[model samples]
Target: MNEQSISQNKIENWREDRLPNLSGKCFVITGGNSGIGFEAAQMLGRRGADLILACRSTQKAASARMMLEATSTGTINLVTLDLADRSSICRASDGVRAITQRIDGLINNAGIMQTPKCQTADGFELQFGTNHLGHFLWTSMLLDRVEAAGGRVVQVSSIAHRLGRIHFGDLMGEKKYSSTKAYAQSKLANLMFAFELDRRLAKAQSPAIAIACHPGYSNTNLQSSGPTGLLNMIYKPLNALIAQPSALGAVPTVLAAAGLEAQRGAYYGPTGFFDMRGPVSLSHIAPHALDLERSARLWAESEKLLGISFLSQD
Candidate 1:
């Protein structure tokens, strides 16, 4: 970086150089089978943190486990977590509760992007259900454990959230739906949830922290796995030129998960222009994500919908 850049951040544009000993730290990362999630799992594993990959496919989890186990300095385990289905989420939570006593970190990284309008098992919009609600529920279910361990929760959002507005009236997209709009809303929800969780943790005088991160533009299968269209065809060719590799994309995630000086309620992302790609630092949060009242409403609505009250003011 140049002199001006250093003056702006003053943190030496640092990345994950060395990590503290995490020999017994346990981190649960969703979507750890591939992409940035897998990269993060590798980073944490190498630091000797036992890993629980809450992924969808058992077959892919097996393959991912073998890959991690080869170079992993810690143990790796897997449990089925289909974020689109409520029953599946609860079952996965039961499995998670059975194994570890406390959780060092919970990375809510798994998500689905733009796709044709679809509903989850409970009739919620696919993007909202999988990206936001499911994670909201899963993280809440594990909050007590995380609190007991004095752990942190890392929420992975996206820059696309800048365009998002929560369509509270049509959350399920039953009235109308656009894939990109739905995705943007879900990502925005991720941010609101992260920040709101931080607020609650503070209110309760809890030791746990809630932080968020964005990977910038990365060439991950997040696009390939979605519906095919003109954008997909064009994006596939441009991905190599425009997007960073998943390894670099995962740096912000690792920093948020285990950074030494990471602050509570902070949102980290690439400091590059438009936040496409660069060194990880504090990224700009959108106006919608700043509305404390809206976040509280969203929290209340989420609790009502999911039928769970994770944080109750004492």
Candidate 2:
């Protein structure tokens, strides 16, 4: 069957596809110290993939490494990556390059959620800067390495993207700010970036591919940490009552990163009950996310904002 047909038709049974032995593969995952990122890392490591857990916290990353080493039969290294800072991103990129020349998978999974109006270290809106712009720069820096390995770039977006609009005039939310809207826009950017990157890779005839996935409504610290006031209060109870386990939520991410049936530019996530939680499968892509014009505009704006030209010729 064709790749798209295989991925779509096997939705109910794809979970049974065992990961192949990856003794020599390398994967770099941002925010791998906890939540779905960590869960995905464990699954990959157990299958013998060398992992570079890019996290902001040395302590947490070290602890996670220890936990992974106990059960994972693969090399688990740590690198520092703070998505909110440009200098930090550059340094982290250098650190990753120092470790390996090729990456089998680069999981752009680190992100912030709804938060009070604030800016990143680079002075852009926190949500947009950290979630979208940060990953944009990081991926550009490492795209060549990924291409060398014929790898995949997995963008971990969110269901909130369904309610997002790219606020080009007010991308930073300086004119009017709503934490929820800002968060949604950032996630939409994530999914859009994946689609745009995949298109660019195809045009360049590069072997690398980009895929997107969401964790559904899995319980994670993001709810308590990012939101404030009313949203935080509401999420606390709702997280326990309705959220799925992080392990289950990480399934789609794992599939995107390592599943052989995952098609280029495809999106995967939960497939039950409003896509909040259930078995892993192909998921819907919002119409706005597929807007070729707007996605290209967002890509251009991203480059302009980040002061970097990315994938211009290749």
Candidate 3:
């Protein structure tokens, strides 16, 4: 197929025939209630994977469970998770471990976009805390389980990451803050973490693989949490024109989660039009995003700050 046609096909069409067999596999997806996340969860569930829908609210998680059960032929479970709260992340990790001894895949899809600057319950910047740090700590706690199952970790990133530059000195956004910058930094961190994790896994000879993907501009609720009023009015029109459907935007993530050709630390996204729209393909990796030094620093800082250590475990 031609590149343009392939991109269009992947976006508009459902290719369930290409999905790998997942009858006995188990997966945990954060933010599985809405948009791309909801679609990804539904797709995975339909393909026969045992699914856990992790959400910040029990009600939303339950609702997501109902939706998945109604639409899928596989088992579905609901679990409470609030990424902005370290205690909540710890509790949820424990819950997951107690329920499942093995986790075949983990999709870190939960995130908040450009909201008004705020601090998490742990006093970290909200976007960075939830989008990057929460997932970091949660994944660390689950590393052994994932390794046991020979699983994969999918980090949902964004194209905006291209504009991001992590400021180690101002990780908390205390000196200066803008919603877009905060969101971009968090997304960039996702890519960094994914690559860094793959490096670690390689060194340790672990079976787990780490990958990253971005949803091409998709029509989702991501903007609803952003600056409201006039800014919302301006973005509404642009979103309508540029955003693909949530199902389409989720292709790269699903591919990363299940595609046989996916390699450790590979980054995937839409392959057309500045990566805002296109067929699923191996996308470009930013030089800074792949910096091992920065990634190691971030990993160590995250471990110290969260008081969780993945490397220390056997």
Candidate 4:
């Protein structure tokens, strides 16, 4: 159907119950062992989608799998994926490739928030390396399979992206670094990658699409994962009052992944109170996030850092 000539037979409120029966669909979710990612996996699993949880710890993965097995109708599997390490991601991708020839969807839901200044295994800034570059390589390696299945890529960004600056001059944050600022840059990169990937996919006439979402003020261990500080202290009480539960927080992600209403390059998040907590809807895309030149540069830099190219022979 044309843009204006649309059918009313599409999903409006995307919730777990409304998810289409995904009987044979297979999805690989990063950080699926806990919080929003786990919730998203469970929701999709209930709808009959086979789940591959790519986690950093096999113990946690097994626990998540055991929990999901009880409630979901589909099979649950796990792969060790340490997004902070390039070799780990490659091994994880290889493991996933062995399991499924085609992937119905890929949820880049793993991330680290404001954390102490650190570098990944490859010496890149921890947040940017794990959140953006890791997913970039992981997705590119699996793009062919996703395209083969006409699947979608769901990238989970955050509201903090509004305050981000790429810091290209010191991308590693070695010259100067602030935890919050670095986190913002990583999230912003996530959105930029989502939009650029979709553009590239369309240009290449690929069937797969790249979509994005933010969980809003979900009270997950994401904050505690970094370092104990004021953010963590206030997070608990603030979350109790304003933050939605993890199940609710995962709605936007599930919408981006399984909802029929989602479109290529479309970003989704909560619709209420500064886009922090409420039902999922069309999210605001910052003007900077749409800068084509910056997007291209970021893509180029990512390839340079990762030593790989995607979607073209060159």
lDDT of 2 by residue, 1-314 (tens): 12244454555535624678878999999999999999999999888899999999999999999999987888898999999999999999999999999999999999889999999999999999999999999999999999999999999999999999999999999999999999999999999999999988999899999989998999988998899899999998898899999988888888889987788888889988888998778886788888889999999999999989998742
For model 4 the TM-score comes to 0.95
- Backbone clash pairs for candidate 4 read none
C-alpha RMSD for every candidate: 3.3, 2.0, 4.3, 2.6
Residue 40 of model 2, lDDT score: 91
Query: Which of candidates 3 and 4 reaches a greater lDDT?
Result: 4
Error in Å for residue 85 of model 2: 0.2
Model 4 per-residue lDDT tens digits across residues 1-314: 11122223333455667689998999999999999999999999989999999999999999999999988998888999999999999999999999999898999999998889899999999999999999999998898889889999989999888898888888889999888889999999999999888888888888999988899989888968884588778777887899888999999888888887777777788878998987677777777888888988899889999989776424
Q: How many clashes show up in model 3?
A: 1
Q: lDDT: which candidate is best?
A: 2
The TM-scores of all predictions, comma-separated, are 0.95, 0.96, 0.92, 0.95
- Give the runs in model 1 whose Cα sits over 4 Å from its true position: 1-12
Segments of candidate 2 deviating more than 4 angstroms: 1-10
Error of 4 at 141 (Å): 1.0
lDDT of 1 by residue, 1-314 (tens): 11223244433344767567689989999999999999999988888889999999999999999999987898898999999999999999888889888888999999999988888999888999899999999998888889989999999999999999988898878888888899999999999999889889988999898989899999899988875687688788778788988988888888888878666787788888688898777887787787888888888888988888878542
lDDT, candidates in the order shown:
0.87, 0.90, 0.83, 0.88
Question: What TM-score number comes out for model 2?
Answer: 0.96
lDDT of 2: 0.90
Error of 2 at 142 (Å): 0.6
Report the number of clashing residue pairs per model. 0, 0, 1, 0
